[model samples]
Structure formats: structure tokens, C-alpha cells
Target chain A: MTATTPAPSAPVAAPEPPVLAAVDVTKHFAVRSAVGARSVVRAVEGATLDLHRGRVVALVGESGSGKTTLARLLAGFYTPTSGEIALEGVPVRQRRGRVERSYHKDVQLIFQDPFGSLNPLHRVRHNLERPLKLHHGVRGKAELDRRVRELLERVALTPAEQYADKFPHELSGGQRQRVVIARALAVEPKVLLGDEPISMLDVSIRLEMLNLLDRLRTEDGLALLYITHDIASARYLCDDVVVMYAGEMVEGGPKEQVIADPQHPYTRLLVESSPDPGRGARDRDALFDADADGLGEPPSLIDPPPGCRFHPRCPFAMDVCRTQAPPRADLGDGRWARCWLHAADRTITQENE
Target chain B: MVTQFVPDTDRPDAGTTSARRADGDVLHVTGLTVEYVTDGDPVRACADVTFTLRRGEILGVAGESGSGKSTLITALTRLQRPPAVTTGGSIVFYPRDGGPAIDLVTATPKALRALRWTSLSIVLQSAMDALNPVMRLGAQFADALRTHDRTLTKDAAWARAAELLATVGISGDRARSYPHELSGGMRQRASIALALACGPELVVMDEPTTAVDVVMQRQILAQVLRLRRTLGFAVVFVTHDLSLLLELADRIAIMYAGRIVELGTARELYDDPRHPYTRGLRDSFPPLHAPLTRLTGIPGTPPDLRRPPSGCPFHPRCPQRFAGCDTDLPELVTKGGHSVACRLHEPTGRPDPVPDPASGPASGPASARTEGGAS
Candidate 1:
């Protein structure tokens, strides 16, 4: 059941296996076209990601980039059309039975809207207690009360009793989200998949929520997959960053390396598009005007461009990009990018020149 | 009839002096107040708000969810429905042709109808709501144009609609499609084009780019700047994002709990914000390039407007609050171009010494004479 230990000659210790991993996962949704013909929406393709204990990985992209679909695949909401999801090195089948229930025990998904997630009719105490009873089988009244208070207090809802009996409507947006987090914690899951958790929060309170998540990761050794369209927030919280564009992982690496020196054109565009007041006013017009033609909307997933999905909008797209998908170019230190400009054989030298 | 609603411009405390009236000012608002009347006490949404917009200038209003930014916009455009009423104010909009300024609050229904798309127009956050779903995009534009100018024929209006669509980077052919046919970014751009259909002197946009992604937001903002330069229409843009405002707005106003706490040029608000709330808001957005640091966001939520805090609405959440802040309501005082409504920046009867502006939250009280004297 254990992984084979590394050799004595190896300097670094063997890292623990990822708690959750999605290998070459792809999802396709079928729909009827306007003309009444069957068609497939290629939502996600070849999305590979891993969430390790105490480490945070950010899946960053815009709307229609299939980041949510990838998260759902990891959470077992959708059965992947191809590839597999493995938990703790064991492959998981997407069947609706005991296997799925056990998988749900180890993983949880937090949605964007806290108001919609929690039942308005139920009290906060009932919300937190049901998960504990179902997941851990704690039946006694006293035990349930103690555990519920602990969950609320862990999320900084002080005194716990004040909030336990309140309905979801009585709480503020941030408080409601904290209650949502408290409910997620009651199950004591090892992996948390947050899909735009803080995007709905007020700007003045978003950092507090991020800090809380970071504290949870450090204290409980939980693996987190943070999905968001905002790159700035991802940089603030994640240990590693993965950039997705048009249902593909365009670039990924350690947070500092990938964000500071992005290799893919889409990643570069994203990093530059994030608003930075330090850039000041003088160069703003130039920054925005220069990319006017290149700022095309994301392609339709139903009939995406042939080879590289980004080729049509990419400024540096070559003939090969239009005809053939480029292989991953290694940027060293575990950083890589899917781009023709970085490919070793064809255009790297020309790009440098 | 409109002259009856216009306040005496010669009044000493009108906030609009003869110099400002004669200048290139496009819109001047003074003592604007809005309230939401419930069965119980009325909830004041906008309290004595005042500002002026110059020709081709961009004024950004930034605040959180309940801070009344949207209410101010509704009041400014005279678009508020029942339960929301503008209790007091004068919104004087000056025509570009050197005509006498018209008071929007008191303009007749016929006069207001004449000015809706010609002198002032609005763009909302969701383009789908602003645009007609059943009508073709070209038809919508043509309807707006031909209605405003009765002399224009349908064919001429359609041609102008295509050109207007082209200005926002949408292809002329796409004008035939319906609102639901285009992408989200394209639909938003079409709304902006529709707002500019009559060449209005002022455009009031409430979070126009909030629904789109950052790349599209940048493109839309860039087009707005370009169009402003060519068309010379002033803008009043409202959003909850301070960082976006810093890059796009010429001047910025920070609102909290139905009042403007700070107003200054973009550079002033970014570099030397006097109000503690402004500083906290600016820091709440994590920097993109600066070395990462742990930021403690402002601790408390915005005050409830129904039972607002005694003095300053932000004092409960402000880290630099003092004993006097609980009782003394500070008036907005302007010095040079920057204005703030914080006791920390006020000059008279100061209980505590002013803290240094450079040293952020932890800096202890220093001599009050430094920046207080400047104000």
C-alpha cells in the first residue's frame, strides 16, 4: 500500500503522492444545434492537474475556459469522457454507488454563490450537523453540539452560539460564506475544490477569506484546488499556478516563475491584463491600445479552431500553429508551456532572433 | 419651468462658483440626497452628495455593495422607481452648444424626454438587460437614432448604426444579428455604441465592464478612452474596483455608507489618500508586481444604512479611529483639488495629533501641523 522509497544516493526525499490527481481528463457535452443536428461541446481537453497535501494549485482562466468543468471532474460531478481521476494513487471510477460515496468523503466542492449553496429554510446548526452525522456517524446530541461549535469557531465565527441558530438570511454575505466553509469542514475532507469562492465577496473582505483558506491548508494539511478567473488573487494564495485557455492548460509552473516570466502567449496576455496601479497612468493607453486587435473573445468550444485553439487570436501564431498542435516545451525546473514559439525545433531560434 | 428648479448660481455656498459655471463643466450636482422609504424610518441612500464633471473627463465612483454607488447613478440619470426617491438636489447639465444649463431634477417630462439620448445617456452593467432581445441589433440602433432625429430616414439611420458598430470594433455584418446571437463582450460593446448613438454630452456608466473578463474589460475601456478623445463626451463611471478606476478614471471618489468620504485626482487618491477608508480600500486589492505581503483587509462590514453609525460611517471599520470620531460628524473639506471628510485631515479642534501619511496603519500620532496646515 505504500510507495517505494527512494534510493539512499538520492539527495531529496521522495515527495508524498498527490491526494487527488486528474490525468489527461477530457469532458464533452452533447447538445442539439440550432438546425437540429447533434453536436458536441468540447468543454475540457487534456487537463492534467495534481493536488498534494498542504499545497495549493490555482487553475486560472476566463469564462468558457472550462476551469469549472475540470474542477467538477476532479470532484466527480461529471464522468470524464477520457482519462481518469485518481485519489491517493488509486484510480476512481465514476459510478454512482459506494465508490462515489467514499470518494465524496475525501473530497468536497465549494461553489461561488454561498447564498444558493446553503438551504434558506434550515438553521446553520442543522446545516453543519447533517454533514457530521452523515460523514462521521456522530449521533449523540452533546457530541454534535460540540463539533458544530468547533467548526464555527474554526472559521472565526466567534462564540458559535450566536450564529448556530441563525438562518442563512440573517447572516451577511461574508458570514454566510464562512458558514459554508464551516459546513465543508464538518466532513473533514482532505481535498477542497473551491470554484471562485471569493469572487462574490466584497473587495474589502476578500483577503480575509484567502487568509483563512491559507491557514486551513497549513494547519490541517489539506490539499486545495483554487479555481478562479482572477490571476491576482491566485498569485496571492497559491503555491503553483496553471493557466488554462480554451479548454487547454497553456502553461504551468511554480507560482513565482510562471507569473513573473510566463512562456505562453495567453499567459502573458492574462498577466498583463490584470490591473496594476503601479503601472500608473502614463502607459495605460499604450498598454490597452496595443492589444486591441489581439484581444479577441474566447473561441466557441463546439467548433474550436483546428490545431491550437488559440491560433486564431494569437499574435505570434505560425502556419504550424494553425495546422498542428505544439508539444509541451520544457522551461526547466518543472515549468513548461504549450507554445510553438518555445518549441525546440521550429521557431525558438527565430523567436529569439 | 426649468428655470424655477435651477438654484441661484450667485448663492455663495452653492459650491459652483461663477468660474466653474463659465468653465467647460458639463454637469454640476449639489446637495443631492436620495432615500428608500420603507414602512418604518426612511433609509437614506445618498446624503448630500456633490461633485462636478468637466468635458471629456472620467470620474470614477468606487464603493462596496451597500455604499449607494448605484443609487447615486440612478439619481443622476433620474431613473429611480418607487420606494426610492430623490429628496433633494440639483443636477445642472450644461449643453455643449453654450445653452443655459438645465436642471435634471425639475425638467418637464417633455423636456427630459428630449434630452434622454441627446444630452445624457446611460449604460448599465448587464448588456442583455439594456439591449432589446427580440429586435435585431441594427434595428435597435436605427430606432434610437431615428427617434432622436425625426428628419433622418430609416436607410440613413441604418447606415449610421453600421458605422457606430464599426467604431466599437464589431463588424458591420454582425449588426444583423440579435442581442443573444453575439458573444458577451460583443453585446457589451454594442450597448456602448447605442449609448453613443446620439452623440450625448455625458454618459453615465454603472460598472459597464464588471461582467466581462479582464482582457475584454481592457479593450472596452481602451475603446471608451479613444471614443472620448474623438467624441469629447464626459463620463461618470461607477464600480466596486478601485484598481480598475486608478488606471481608467481622471479623478476618483470613494463612497462609504451613502456619503462620499474622499475625492481627488487618480494620482492623489493612489499616492496620498487622507481618509483611512480610502487607504484601506486601495490596499485591499493585492498588487500584481510588488513583493507579496500579508494584507489584513478592513476588519468590519459596511454599516447598515437603516441604523448607520453615529458620526463617520467608516469609523467602525477604520483602524485609525479615535474617541472624537464617535460623536463628531466631519464635513467634506476641499484643499487644492483633494477633498476628504475625515477628522484626521481636518484642521480645527483636533483632539489627537495627525499621523504621518507615509507610515500607514501602525504609525503613532505625530505633529498635526504638517499636512493639516496644508489643507
Candidate 2:
């Protein structure tokens, strides 16, 4: 059955490789427990993702699901305990001097908090110019000022001069975020890793920020990794969706397929739990009852449950599920999920349909 | 327009009379105004907010961060600290035993103390802040339960505490764990269980589920609904997420610039919102099931309340605003059970034709997408 399924999109004539990719990446942090016992928090384990130019892949998960950890690994902030991080088909190495600086110039990370990202003492122009000078080494005040204004305009901060001179404290949350984006664009990076970029902004302006990111992707051919807990917003802006549970990637595919017909129990729970006002009370009541019985909190990373991380809370937990991790079951059209229910020998089409 | 403000002493029976008229009203707040007395001119955080919460009904107060929804909650519970004062308003509570109504604003400290846990309880956003960090979950619940009921023994209180925790889906044995030992979702559920330890008539939850994940948020909300159904306690759930309120709330009040701009049944607000601000807020959330489309959110930021817009606070950002919107302040007047404060809804204010729903700037992308089908 795996051999019968066609290759993902049958890339006509060898498609261009992803701008950035994490192959089987894992990160673990050592911490002391309440009793002073040493423990390891397995933040991310064997997570693989590829960010193609002009494409947005949303990393959707709960608070401690290690989506952010995967992003940080890709950003070169933390060296992976295992596996590899490749940029433009070249493996990235952990080093200081010029190689690391060059990697930063190619990939820029937009932090969640706009207020803290910028230097409070400097003007917006200074913040934007520092990157251009350090990364691109563009000398002369005239060139730097021009590039700074252009960056601001690219982010839709109108009358660039007005915003260029203002301090971080003077701008609104949305405006400050725009400045943050402008600073990221200063280096003309190939990949933008947004870590919950719009979560801190007001609800009304969040869409605008998403739209801006979308524009950047289309116009600049920049690959984007949008990390957010909001499934609806992810569906709105992301072309592909990746569902993570307990520091492991569970299911991933085209946004529509994954969101509309989730294969994994955890992914299904996430899609069902997202607030959809269009649902009637009767439907929600049934959903609530089903959720109340089976739903449990994400497991602790330090001593995660053996076998399937989600088996403890999964309604379809089988004997094998509690003893061993499930293998990845490939569904056609770039859809795949890690679940025993979708094992190759089992009939997938009839069950999923 | 400037009528003489009368103190609560003048209308001692106002609560009873209103409660009798409404019959099922658990809380009646009239002319609720809260202000922050700063060095400069005082800023009114909640201006003339008025609403009635029905018995066993979930009333959701939706607003942005600085839109004063939190201030309204604090003022309603009489938890506002110094500098934040309830300048004008009366919160009349109708006791379940059919006793005389007590005006919370004018009630003495001793009278308020008598009503604390037995009549009302609160759940804050941060469960760690509400729960005792160093104490066990069961002990905290016992403290609240025993303090309210002196007749109950320590063993009985502890048993009741375990039972309450069980109601919220936490195991009885887990109640012995401290707040830090539990997960974020468990701690939040524990705080909720503590709030209900006394079997209070009304629960004031301020973003109780905001700190948890969406899956856990659904569980917490479902538990609240189940508990409310069994116990028959009213709820005033406040959150900045309007979409969450649409599903959880029986009635929703949309606030902007320190005022209740619109109030109606959740269905009414969802299907056909009367106020422009309400419409914008409803459209702000992207639908999970609908075909994805470009959504143009409300263009501008909420006005700074210290120097709010001249007339209608929402006019500056309102796409459908007209000549009269900036000159005359519209009052929140009810028509056909739905209340809206906007010039477009006011009959005498203007005869301007309503903008075509399909032609509005925000309507293009929204109408292009199909309605979300049943899950």
C-alpha cells in the first residue's frame, strides 16, 4: 500500500530544495526537580520539518508541546542533541566567528513580544540601521537611512520618517511589532521564523499582521515558519499544518485536509476544541461530553509516558500503543500521521473516510 | 441630559422592585461607573455600564485589554483597590432565600463579609494568584469551606473539598498536591473547584480559561457548563476573546471605550449584530471550518479613554460612521430585546440609509466565504 501511494505531488523535474530544514532534530534541557533530583526535559524529540521558499508551514501545538523548541533549533539558537539542521541544502555547524553570523543574516527570528524585542533607548531608525550595518555592512548614513526607510515602508508603516524617529515607547503594540518586522527584513533574510508573532497584539489587529506576513512571503519569496496555538489563524495564513503533541510531531499535511479530516486523535481534539461559533449548542454539548471523558492534559516532558506519548489520554489506545511508539502511516497528497490505527496493514481509506 | 444623581439610600427597595419585575434576575447593576483617579483628570474605566445577569445564565463580558471589562468585574465584586473607585452605580444582589436585597456598593464591610463565600465567589485569570501557592489544593478548598460554615468539622470540610475537586475532573487523591505540583490546566480547574466549594449562587470568572491550552480550555468550559447546569449558579465570564464567549455565554455584552456598546443573546449577536463595533468584533475571529479568505480586521486601535473620541468613541474607526456619529453620543437603547448604542440604530438621530452588508469593506472577504458547516 505504501508503494502504491504516489510520491508527494510528484515534483516535476526535481523541485527546489527547502530554504531551511530540520532533520530528526531533538533538544533536551536538564533541570532540578523539587527534591533536587536531576531530570531531563525532552523538549523536542526527532522532529523533522522543511520550510520552502514562498511557503508557510504552521507549527500548531499547546503550550509545552515543544513547537517553540523546534523553531529555536532551526534558528541556530540551540545546538541539536542529535540530527541535523540544513540551510539551503547545506548542513549548519555550531561555530562563532563568521559562519554563525552569516547564518543569522540568512535566517532572522521574530520574537513574540514586540515591546521587548526592540532596544528601548534607540530610535526605530537606529534599530533598523544596526542590522543593515552589522549584517550587510552597508556604510554611509545616506545608504543606511534609505534602507531603513525602505524597510519601514515594506512593513506598511506609512510616512517612514515619522515612525523612523520615534522611540519604541512611542509606538503602539501593533506599530512596534511592525518595526520589529521591519528590522527583520533589514538583512533581507531568506527564512522568517515568527514565534507567536501576533499573539501579543490585539485581536482586531492580528489579522493585519498575518496579512503583512503573507505579503512578505509572496513578494519576497521568503519561507515562513508561523508558530501559533490558534488553529483558526493557522488555517487562515498557513498553506501546510503540523500538529505536535508532547514534544513529538503527530500529524502533518495540507492545511485543509488536516483541519477538515484529522487522522490522529490529538489533532482531531485540537481542531474540535478551537472555538467555532458557527457550531450549534447540541453539537457542542456532544463534543463536550466526549471530550470530558477522554481528554487529559499534555504529559510532563521530564518523565513522559512510555510508548505513544498520547496513549494515556487517547481513546483508541490499544495494547501495542501502550508498549511501543507507532510508525508513520503515509496518506497520499502529502498527508501522514503517526498512529497505530493507521498502520499499513490496517485499512486506512475506509476508516479515515 | 444631566439628571441629579441620587444615592443608593434614597431607593432602598429598588433592588426588590426590579427583581420582582424581572423575576429571574440574579444581579441588577444600574449606572455602573468605575473611575481611576489619577493626578490628572480622572479616567472613567467603566462608564454607565448597565446589565442584568439572569439566574443560572452565563453572561460574558467581551472587550479588549484596556476596554474596561476587567474593571467592571472588579467593581462588581467590590475588589477594586485604591485609585480605582466605583464613582456612581448600584450593584443590587437578590439573595436566593428571598431576603432583602443588599446593595453591594453601599453595604457595610461587615455586611459584605457576611455575603462573601456563601453568596458570591471569584476565579481570577492566573490560578496561581488565586490559589495558595504553598498550601495543598484540598487544604485551600477546606479553608474556604470551613471559613464560610463554622458548623462543619475539619474532616467534613476536607471530604467536601475532595468532592469539589472531583467535580472539576481532578482526582480525589490529587487534591493533596500543592498548586505548583499540578499542571496549568489542573491548577485552573482547582481554583474553579475552590470557588464553588461554598456552593455560591454566582461565580465571577475573569478569563479563567485564558491561561490554558485550547483543548484544556474546552474541558474547563464544559465542566463549568455541567456544574452550572447541576448546581444552578449564575456566571459572569469575562474574556477578550469574543469567539469563546459566543460558544460559552448565554448572553454577551460587547464593551468598548469603557462602555457597553452592545448587549444581546449570543445567537442574536452572532447572526445579526446591531452595533457596528459588535459586528467588527464578531468578524475579527477567523472561522475554523469555513473556506479561508482574506479578512480585513477593524482598521484602527481602540481609542485612548483619557481623551476618547468626541461623540461616539467607536466612530473614528467605524467604517459605517456618518455625519451624526461624531456629533451626538448614542445611548444604549433596547429594541426587540437587543440593545445597541450606535447612531445607525437610533431612529431619531439620522435617516441615513444603512450601508449595504455586501458593499462594506469588511463584508467582501467575509461574504465570499461559505458559512461553516456542521462538524
Candidate 3:
């Protein structure tokens, strides 16, 4: 796939059609301030990405970076103020009743908090069976019973009978998370959107969930859009990586390239800041202070900084960076970055590196 | 009273004067047990926990949800509300400025009020609730300060509050604004500043950085460490992130099912973990610098504290569990400063057993693998 083909803008040669694609998707919300002044919060600004079948694309960013807003946009929960989200090359339209049911079946979202997502009042069997009946019309006591047990077993919640009768509060954190995953899979969605799925889980059991997601991608051929702030886990579970800073896609490419050789300054700081114990005897005090004066907190979305939204925190801001937005710089071989430092016309200075 | 299992050898921190009890020991917790007095049954939230905090040293408590990390902190500070009761053990606070060691568990209400902010303080997990929404940041700081030291004038308290806010990298002027006006990072910084208002000898922080972004989390931790070094105070940093503790803490205690499963220095646990659960936790998260490899996740869930496992709490999910692990409880044995309570690390049969640090995926132990291959 890495033939190093030359292109002026955009990467990825489109080896296969995207199962789900967002073309320059933008979502804005009008928020009223304490002063009664109306302003539009540019939560997601013109972000474009694609999810290919059987592949995992990770959306990496800090809080208020609009990564969650982007996922919600893809889930058809929010209508894009500007662009559009398409599934299998067809634009998704808002409809009533059963018409939206098929679209919901095609795309499923797994939330971060397992405890809040599941219903505390209902038993585990009902949680899985409700989705199955609503989506697939699997009726009758026997049919519902079989499908419910199968869903539980699919998520490795066994013995299935024991877990099926128990309430959500009775299950462990890991077990509850598994049940959530099972409910998501009950609909048999081709595109699975998970927002920080394992962040709330324990370290000892986080890998189990990741491996389960990876297996689902291979066996069920599901396309995954994994969103997380943890860079190491993204590289571990994903094939492609997208780095977003303040509602803008800064750098993205194959997971290895983005993680191994990060181009954007923000991406570099994120990779360096993620704690890794195996690195051995690092002078941490000095390392923490090195980036102290580099970048400020994420700018306000209602009135974000002009030009490159990251310029305020970006260590290598320039006059042009303050004045104009940077174009996507094509690094070829499916690798690209959105920073003025990588612009072809700009003269590369020592400060840029 | 619960039967306490103390480490059976001399600690590695015994040599340094800073590690000695007479000079630098700030807090000593022994056989601490806490239970939630529910209608059905008393649930053991924390059991038989023991550890020592040295002056200016950061002791991290790492565990998953339901592991009683939060319960331990709440009980140690004598802040447990109704429905939660400390059933056993004691917490002794050794004051640094030539004061008698006070027992927190049995202290009188008057003594506790005197000790609240002057000698001990807490940085609550959520920064939002830590400050009153109706009160301004300056007022919050001033309230804590004046409550402890009524002799200080209001003007003097405000001045100190401003100075403390500045110490945590927030502007002194922002203290006049209400909590809602400030950003999350600023509010968290203010809460930290409020915690340091009285210059307590020991600060108990419960996931202070979990609410913010990674960049801000690192910044807050760096600020905390800097403040600790300058103020000469110890810290009990509690969080679910073991990886973060690798760089932040001098010593770490890994908790599982209400018990401290392993206690050791950061380097010792990271390099040569003796407990299977500790090894599982170490390998669970992928390292940023290391080559990409499949991780081995520990299967099963944390035991129900109400009816915890009979032997080692981690035995059911342990990848290398043997007969003794499920039946006979392993006492915590000390090797230098690192203490582990697993059958493999027990000194009964094996004088020297090779620890498999390699994170193999769901595949059992090396012996099990070889046996399977031969069969």
C-alpha cells in the first residue's frame, strides 16, 4: 500500500470504498452566553475522514477538541450544519419510525461509561433482547431466549444463563462493559463508533476489551472508529490515526507513521507526555518543564483563535500561521499533516523543526 | 479485629534518615479496615491495609474501580460519612514541627477540627464540587484559612490566598471570580491552591488530574511535585492509573479487591513484578516507546468484597494459579522493599524462580505451554 505515490493534497489512495465516510463534515451549535449574546460554537470544523471495512481508524485528541462531537455527528445524532455523512456512498437522511431503524442498525455507538449506558432496572437478558426485537423483529419467547443467550456468549459472558438473569448492578465493571459490547453487536452494525470505550475500565482488563474489538473487526468485518486521548492504545488497536486539535485535523496517516514519526508539534507533545514505564530512568522533572511554556489550554470553541486554531498553544507559530490557515501537506505513501511547517511553498526554518 | 499481615523483613527505606520514623515519617497506617454498613451485609470496602508515608515522598495507591482505593483514602483522613464505618486498625500522624503523633481514628472532634487544615488536608477527586459554586475562589481559600487560624485577619487571609493561587500558576486576580467563570484547568489549580492554603504536612489527593486533559494532568502533577519539594510535605496520591505513578511516585501500592496486593518502589514493580496480578497490570497498557505487541489482559472481574475469595483475591483470574493459591492465603513477604503475596513469590518450594515478564496473550504459563506441546 506504501508505493510513495505523489499527490498535492490528501492521502490514502482509496484502495477500497469507504464503508462510512464524512466529507468535510462541520457541526456548529448556537450557545447563549451569560450576557445574552448569541454566538455559534464551531464544535467540529470541516473535518474529513473515512472508515474502511475491517479496519480501525482512531480519532485522537484532548477534551473539547470536538472528537466526541465528530463521533456524534457520524452517528446521525446531530445534523451537520455544513457538510454530510454518507454510508455506502448514500447520504443519510432523517426519517421517522422504521426507516431510521435500518440506519441505526447499520451504525452503532458504544459509549465510554458502561454503568450509565445500561438500564439498571432491566435484567441483562432484556437489555440484549430489546435491541434484537426492535431491530430484527426476533419475536417469541424461545427465539428471544436463544438470541439473548447467544449475544451474551458472543461477548464471552458465561455461563450465559447466569448472566442473562442478573441485573446490571450485579455484574462487575468488566462484565457490564462486555454486556454493553454485546448489545451494540446485537444489531450487527457494520460501522462501530466507540468513544473512549476502555478508559473507564481497569488497566488489567482494558487489553481484554481491545482484543475483543480487534477480533470483532476481523471476524464480523466491522469498521471501527476508536476515539481516545491515549496515543499508545490507539497505535495498539488501530490501523490509521487522526490527530485533532481544537476542531481541526492536524496530522493523520497510518498508525505506525503517525506514532513513530509525528510531524505536528502538538502530536509530538502528546506522544512524549503519554507515560511509558519501560522507557527506563528518564529525568521526568526536566521533561515536564521542557513543554511548560509550549502550548496553552485548548482555546474556546465559541470564539476560537483565528488562522490555525492551535497557534496559541503551538510552540512553532509563525506570522502566516497567525494570519492564514494551513493546507494539508501531502507526505505521500498515505501520510499527511496539516501544519504550515509542512507546506511545500514555505521555507523550512530551524524553528519549524 | 482483622489479622494483620505485616511484611516480614527490613524495608529498603530503613537506611536513609528521611525514611526513618524519628526524623521524616509523617503518617503510619496499620491494619486499616473499612466496611459499608448496609442492610443486607457489611461490605468490606478496604481491609487489612498498611503502609507508611515519609516526609516529602509521594506514595501512590493504584487500583481499578471497586478496589477500595477511594475508601482507603476516605477512612485514613477520618472523613467517612454515614453507611461507611472504619471497623479496625489505626492511622497515626507524626507531625513534622515537633508535635505528638495523633491517632486519626480515635481523635476527638475538637482535635480533628484543629488538625483539619493546619496539619492535614484533602484534594477531593472532583474539582467542581470541591468549591462552592456560590462562593468566589478567594472566599473559598479564605474560608479554609480563617477556619484553621482565626488570629489571621481577613485581609491577611486574602493575601495568603492570592499568593497560594499564584504558586499553582493561576493569576492572583482571578480569585475574585466565581468558580464557574474559570476554566477546568484553572478551577483545578484553584482547588489545589485551596488545599495548600494551610501548608498541611500531608495532602491526600484522590484522582485530582482525572478531570482534565493529558497535557493539563501532567502540568498539575508537575506543579504538585514542585510544591511538595519546596514545602517539605508528604503526599498520598491515589488514582487508577499505574502508568502515571511510574514517574510520579517513589513507592506504589497496588490494591485488588480491598487488599494491598503488592507494595514496592516504582522501579522495582515496573521491572520485576513478583505478583501475577501486578505483572498483568504492568503489561495491560501498551508502552509508547516499546515496539507494538499484543497485550495480555487479565480475565474475570474484581471479586465481590462482600464475599471476597477465600484465599488470594486474585487467584480466580490469575494466569499462573496453583493449588495453594486458591486454598491457602499467601502472606506478604518482603524482598528488600518490594513486598508480594503470591504463591510463586512465597519462599516455600522455590529458592529462585524465574519471573516471566514477557506479556504473552491469554496463553498460560511457560510450563503449561510446554506441557501442552508435549502432550
What is the lDDT, from 0 to 100, of the residue A72 in candidate 3?
91
TM-score of each: 0.93, 0.93, 0.91
Using TM-score as the yardstick, the better of models 2 and 3 is: 2
List interface RMSDs for the candidates, in order: 5.9, 3.2, 5.6
Order the numbered candidates by DockQ, best leading.
Answer: 2, 3, 1
| Per-residue lDDT of A12 in model 1 | 26
Residue pairs in candidate 2 whose N, alpha carbon or C atoms collide under 3 angstroms: none
**Top-DockQ candidate index:** 2
Question: Model 1, range B50-116, lDDT digits (tens) per residue?
Answer: 7777788899999999999999999999999979998887777878997766777777778889899
Q: Which fraction of the native contacts appears in each prediction?
A: 0.63, 0.63, 0.61
lDDT of 3 by residue, B1-375 (tens): 111223424222321132324456777777778999998889999887887787888889999889999999999888899798998877777777766677788788888888888888899878898999999888888899888887989898888888998888887888898999988988888898898889899999999998898888878877887888789778899998888998888888899988888888888778777788888787777766556556666877777787888888898998887666777877666677787777787768344564555643323233321101210
Displacement of the residue B327 alpha carbon in candidate 2, Å? 1.9
lDDT of 2 at A350: 24
- Tens digit per residue, CA lDDT, model 1, A1-353: 22121222212222767788887788999999789999999999887787888778899999999999998888899999987789998999856777887888899999999989999999999999999998899999999999999999999998899999999999989999999998988889999999999999999999889989988988898889999988878878877789999898888887767777888989988888888776655665776673484468899999989877899888888999999877766666667788888885532311110
The candidate 3 chain B region of ten consecutive residues with least summed lDDT is B366-375
Off by over 4 Å in 2: A1-14, A280-284, A290-294, A346-353, B1-21, B356-375
**Can you rank all candidates by TM-score, best first?**
2, 1, 3
Between the candidate structures 2 and 3, which one is better when assessed by lDDT?
A: 2
On residues A113-160, what C-alpha lDDT tens digit does candidate 3 reach at each position? 999999999999989998898989899999999998888888888899
